[model samples]
Target: MEATDCRRAFPSFDEPALKATFDITLVADKELTALSNMDVKEEKILESGKKATSFNTSPVMSTYLVAFIVGELSYVESNYFRVPVRVYATPGMEDRCKFSAELGARTLEFFEKKFDVPYPLPKMDMVGIHDFSAGAMENWGLVTYRVVDLLFDEENDNANTKQRVAEVVQHELAHQWFGNLVTMDWWDGLWLNEGFATWMSWYSCNSFYPDWKVWETYVGDNLQSCLALDSLRSSHPVEVPVKRADEVNQIFDAISYSKGSCIVKMVSIILGEDTFIRGISRYLKRHQYGNTETGDLWKALSEESGLDVAGIMDTWTSKVGFPVLTVSEDGNTIHVRQNRFLATGDVKPEEDTTIYPLSLALRNKSGKVENINLDKREISIDLSKYDASSAFYKLNADQAGLYRTLYPPERVVKLSQAGADNLLSVEDRVGLIADTASLSVSGYQKTSALLDLISLWKNEKEPNVWMEMLKRFGAIRKTWIFQPESTTDALKQLLGELVLPKVNELGWNFHAEESLLQQQLKGTLFSSAVSSENDKIVKEALSLFEKYASGDAKAVHPNIRAAVFGAAAKYGDEATWQRLVDVYTSPKSSVEGLAAITALGGAKNVDLQKKTIKLTLDGTVRSQDVFYVLNGLSTNVAGIQILWDWLREEWDAITKKFPANMGLLLNIIYICTGSLATPQHLKEFDEFFKSKDTKGFDKAVSISRDRLVSRIAWLERDVKDVEEWLAKHQSSTKL
Candidate 1:
C-alpha cells in the first residue's frame, strides 16, 4: 500500500493534529526480516508459518511520517538516548550496516542535543531496502533506506559515498521533527519541510565530517537539477499545489528539495543563523501537531527578523523560473539586470520587472567579502575607490543567493577556467561549470572552458578538493564526448594517469571503483569515434564483465551485477551478447531479469530491440519491471518508437486495467516524450497528448516543452510547425 493509503489504516489526518497509535504488523518473508519504531513487542511463527512480528506504536503523533519495511535484513543493534537503534541491511550486507549505525547514532545524538527534545520514539530502525525508490524516507522512528544510501561497507572507504550516507541519514533524521512532528498543511508548504531538511542535512553533515564541504557539495549537485527545472516553462512555484494524492509525489524534486534548501540557506545567510534557527524553533512549537502553510513559515521568520519574508520569498518561490543577475562593470558603476537562462537553451529571459531580494556578494582581490542587495532591475556599485588591480567580484560569493550569473562574457570565460578553488566557492563553482557546459553545447562556451575544469585538480593541494575536481571534470568529459574519434590517446593518458590514479589512490573498494568505472566508461567509450582503440577499451570492459559475471553469485552485489551487464551491453562481442540474451531467457534469472532486458534492448539488432519492448509490455511484466525497460528504450530513437507504439496500442487498456500504472505512465511520458519534445517530434507527439487533467498532464507537457521542445527550437531555428501543432492540440484537448 502507498504511504498515503495508510492514513485510513489508522485514525490519521494529513495535518499534524492527529495523535494515534499505529498498531503495526508485518508478515516477513522467511527469506527477509522486519523493523519498526518500538522494540518488537510480539514475535511469533504464525499458524500458516510466517515470521509475524509487531512493534509497539509510537507516542501520540501525526501518522504520515510513520514507515515500515520487510526485506532480507541483517542489523547491528545498539542503544542511544535510552532508545534502541538498529541499522538493518540485506543478508551478507552486515558489514555495510556498521557505517550507517555509526552515522545514524551520531545523527540521533546531534538532533537530540540541537533540538533539546527527548527522543520521542521507543526504538529507531534504519532498514536498507534494495528496491526502495527514494534516497531514504523518515518514517517517524522507523526509517527505510535504499541499500546504497544507508549501507556503507567497512572495506569501502570511498569518502564521497560515505559522506553522502552520513549526510542523507542526518537529513532524514532531522525530518523526524521538522516534517513528521510538524506537518505541512498543504503540499505548498513542502519547501518548509524538505527545504529545511536539505539545509539541515548539509549543515549537520558538515559538522560531522569537517573535511567534507557538505553545503557546497550539496549545492553543486542541486544546482544542476534546479537550473534544469527552473529554466523549464513548466517550472512551478516552490510552494506548488497538491490537490490530489499523485501531486504529492511530483513535488519531491530539486526545487522542493535542493532549491528549496538553497532558499532556506539564503534566508539563514541573510537573516543570520541565530535568527533562522530561532524562527524555525518558534514555527515548530507553534505548529506542533498542527497544520501550517507557506505563509506560516514566512510569518515565523518575519516574527524573528522583523522583516517581510512574504514579499521576497514569494516572488522567488511563487514563480517558476530563476533570475539571471547580469552584473556589468562600466568604469566604477556595476550594472545588474535579472534574466532567465535555461539549462538547455535561453528561452524566457528575465522581464524588466521581475524582482527578488538580490543577496549579493562581492569579493575583492584581497579576498575580503562584501554584501550588497539589488531591489530594482539595475543597481550601480561604485568600485572606483577600490584598487584597480583589486577589481574582482563574485556575486553570491558563498552561493548564498539563488540565481544564475549574467556577468561579462570575459568574466564567464574566466570563471570557467578558474574551477572551484579560485573564482568561486566550491559549491558555487559546480553551478558555474554546469551552466557553462550547457552553453558549450550551443557554441556560446569555449571547449577550453571544459578542458580547464578537467585539468583543474592537478594543481590542487587537498585530496578532497582534487577528488571533487576530478569527479566534475570526469563528468564534463563524458558529456562532451559523444561522437566517434572524440577520444584521443592523450586524453586517455590524462584520465588514466590523473583521473584513474586518484580513484585508485582513494582505495574506493571494488564497489566504488565499479561505480566510477561505469561513469568513466560512459564518457570514454562513445566519446571517441569508432576506432581500434575504442574497440580495445570496449573489449577490456567486456572482459571485466565476463570475469565478474562468472564469479560467485553471492560475491557480487545486485547493483554491481547490473552495471557489469550494462557495460557489457554497451561494449561486447556477438558471443557476449548471446550470453546476455541467454541470461534474460533463463527461468532461473534473478531480480536482475529486467536489467538483462535493458542490455538486450540496446543490442544493435533491431529484432532484439523490438523483443525487449515486448518483454516489458507483456502481461508477465510487473509494474516495477517497466522502469528498466523504459529506460533502455529511452537511449535511442528506435527504442522510443517501440515504446510509443506500445503506449498507443495499450493506452486505453493500461489506463483502465492497470490502475497502478497511471502514475508510472505519467512519469514515463514525462521522461520519454519529454526527452524528445523537440520540434521534429512535437507534431507526431500531439496525437497522443490529451489535456484532460491540466494539473496532472500539463506538468509533464510543460516539462517536455522546457527540456525537449525549447532545445529543439534553438537547434532547428524554427518552431512554426510545432507551435501550430501545439496550438491546435491546446484548443482541441480538454486541458
Candidate 2:
C-alpha cells in the first residue's frame, strides 16, 4: 500500500495532497504485536477471545505513510534523543539488525538538529524483510528495508557492506523529515522528496563518517549514474508531467534521483553549507505535516539565503540535459560560453538560446577562489589583477557545479602535467576525468586523449580518483572486448598496464591506520586486477581461493571475496564451479550469496553461460536480484551472444514475469545492450524489444538502443586510435 496503491488497503483518498489523520485498528493473535504510525492507545479482547489493538490518530500524513504491521518479528531497541528506535528482522536474524539500529538512531538524532525539527513520532521501527525491494521505504514511524541493505554480520561482512547499510539507513531516516513530514503534493514533484533525500543521505553519511569520502562517492557513483542516463535521447526532465500511474513509474529514474540530487548539491555549494542548512530548516518547519511542491522549497531557501535559489535552480530541474562551459582567453578576461552538453557530440537546434543559472567558480593563479552566478549564456571574468597572461584560469572551481567544463586541448595538456594532480582538488580531477570519458565515448574526444590525461593519474593515490578511473576504464573496455583476438589481447595488456601498477602500489593486504575508504579501494583494485588478468594478480587470487577452500584461517578476507571467487570461476575447472554453486544455493547472507552468483556468472564456458542465463529467470535467483545474473552474463565475453539468444527465446515470459515492477527490466536491458559493438547485436536488440509489448518500456528501449548506437560510434571513432596507442605504448615499454 505504499507507492500509489494505498487504496487497495482501505477506503481513502490516495493522492499525496489529500493528507489526513489515520486511526488504525488491528485484530491479531494475542502473542503478536501490531505497530502503526502512532503509539498504541488501547488493547482489548474481542468476543472471539482475540486481541484487538487500536492506535492513536496519526499526524496529518499522506496515504503512503499510513501503514501497520502485525507479526511476531524480533527487534533490538535503543533510544535516540527522546524517541525510541527499534530495528527488526526475522527471528533467527535478530543479531544481524544491530548495526542498522545503531546507525539509524544516530542518523535520526543528527537530522533532528540539522532539520531544526524534532522527531514527531514517539517511536520508530526499522524493519528488514527478506523479500522487500527499492532498497528501503520511508513509512513515517516504520521504515521498511531489504534484508541485504539492513543486515550485516561482523565477521562475514566487509567495510563496504557496512557502509552500504549505514547509507541506506541514513537515507530512509532523512526521509522521516523530507518525505514523511512534508511530502510532495503529487508525483510530478517526486524529485523534491527523492532528490533531497538522495543528496542528504550522502551529506549526512559524510558528516558521520568523514574518512569514507561519501561526497566523492556521490560524485563517483550517483552523479555519474545520472550523466549516463541523461546523455541518452530518451532521458526525462526532473519535473516530469505525471498524468497516469505508468508515467509515475517511469519518472523514478536516474534523471529524477541523480540529476536532481546533483543540482541540489550545486545549489548547496553556492548557498554555502550553513546558509543551505538554515534554508532547509525553514522549508521543513513551514511545511511540516503538509504537502509541498518544488516552488515552496525555493521560496523558503530564497527567504533565508537572500538569493533567488529557486530561480537559479529552475532551469536545471525543468530541462532534460545540462550545459558544458567552454572557456577561452580574451585579452585581460576569460570568456565563457554555455552550450548544451550531449554525449553523442554537438548541440540541438532548440538548445541554442537554452540557458543555465551557472554557479561559476574561477580559480586564479594564486589559488584564490571567486564564485559567480551566470544567469545568461555568456559571461566574462577579468583576470588582469591575477596576471592572466602567465597562467590560465580554472572554471567550475573544485567542480562545484553540476555541468562539465571543456578546456582547450593545449590547456588540458598543461593541466595534465606531472605533479599537477596535487595542484587541483580531487573533485575537479574527478570531474575532468568523468567529462573527458564522456567526451571520449561520444567522439568529441579521442580515447588516446583520455588515455594521456589518465596517465597523469598513474601516480594518483586518492581512493575516489582511482574508483572513477576504474569504472570509466571498465565502461570503455566493455565496448570492444569482443574484438579480433589480437586486438583484444593488445587491449587486455594495455588495460592491465593501466591498473596493475596501482594495484601493486596498494597491495592486497589491509594496512594499519588505513581508512575504510582506502580498504574498500583494495577490493575495487583487485577486481580490476582480475578483470585485466594480470599474471601476478591472477596467481595470487587463485592461491587465495585454493587456500580458503583447503580451510586456511586467513586466506581470502571477506572484503575481496567476490574478486577471489570470480578469479576461481574464470580460471578454475568443473570442480571449482560446482563448489561455488553449492555454496551459492545454501543459506547465507545476501552478500555471500550474491558473491557466489557473481562467480558463477563469470564462468568462461558457454555451457556454464547458458546455465547462468536460465538461472536469471528461474526461481534460483530472487526476482529483485535477477539483474545480477543478467549483468554477469553480459560481462563475460563468452556469453554476449548467448544472452541475446536467451532474450529472444524468452522475451514474453520475462516481460510478463514482473507485472508489478517494470523498471527492473530497464536495468537488465542496459546490461544486455552494453556490449552491442557489432551491427548484428543492435539488430537483434531491436528485433526483440521493438517487436514486443514495450509500450511502458519505450524510454528504456530508447536508452538501450542509443547505448548500442553510441558503442558502435565509439568503435568507429576510437578503436583504431586506441589500437595504435596501445601498440606504441607496448613497444616503448619493451624498449
217: Cα error in model 1, Å: 2.2
Clash numbers, per candidate? 9, 0
The TM-scores, one per candidate, come to: 0.77, 0.95
lDDT of 2: 0.79
- Tens digit per residue, CA lDDT, model 2, 1-735: 556768878888888899998888999998887888788999999999889999988888899877788888889887754687898887888778888888888888889988889989888898887665477888988888888899988767777898989888888898899988989988988887888888898888889889888877777788888887887767778898889766676677788888888878887887887888899999999999988889999998899889988777787888878777887865667778888777766567775466877768777666677767787888877877554442656677666677777767777786766225476778777777888888788776788877787766777888888888777877767887777777777767767877888788878787557788888888888888898888888999999999977877358777898899899988778788777776667635778777877787788876777777787777877877777677677775777777777767887787777543446776766677767687787777777776677656667778878878888888888888988887887898899
Clashing pairs in 1: 16-289, 324-339, 484-528, 484-529, 485-528, 485-529, 486-528, 486-529, 487-528
lDDT of 1: 0.61
Model 1: per-residue Cα lDDT over 1-735, one tens digit each: 223555665545644444466678788765667766666788888887788888876666655666667766678876654676788865676776777776777788877777656567777888877555456788887788766577775442233456568778888898888877777766678777888888888778768766555565555566556766776656777877667776766667667887787788778877887788778878877876666778888899999999898877877777666766767777557778765555555554343246666767766656567777777766777764433231455666656567766666777656655544465555556556555555544334444554555555454433334434454545434332321232323344445545443433432124433433243333322222122234444454456566656864444334344544666765555666667666655523233455566666556566666766665556545554466677776655567667767766766665554343144555666655644634446766665665334444566666765555554544343223223433443455445
What lDDT is reached at residue 17 by model 1?
44
Best by lDDT: 2
Off by over 4 Å in 2: 29-33, 42-51, 329-334, 379-382, 386-390, 418-421, 551-554, 660-662
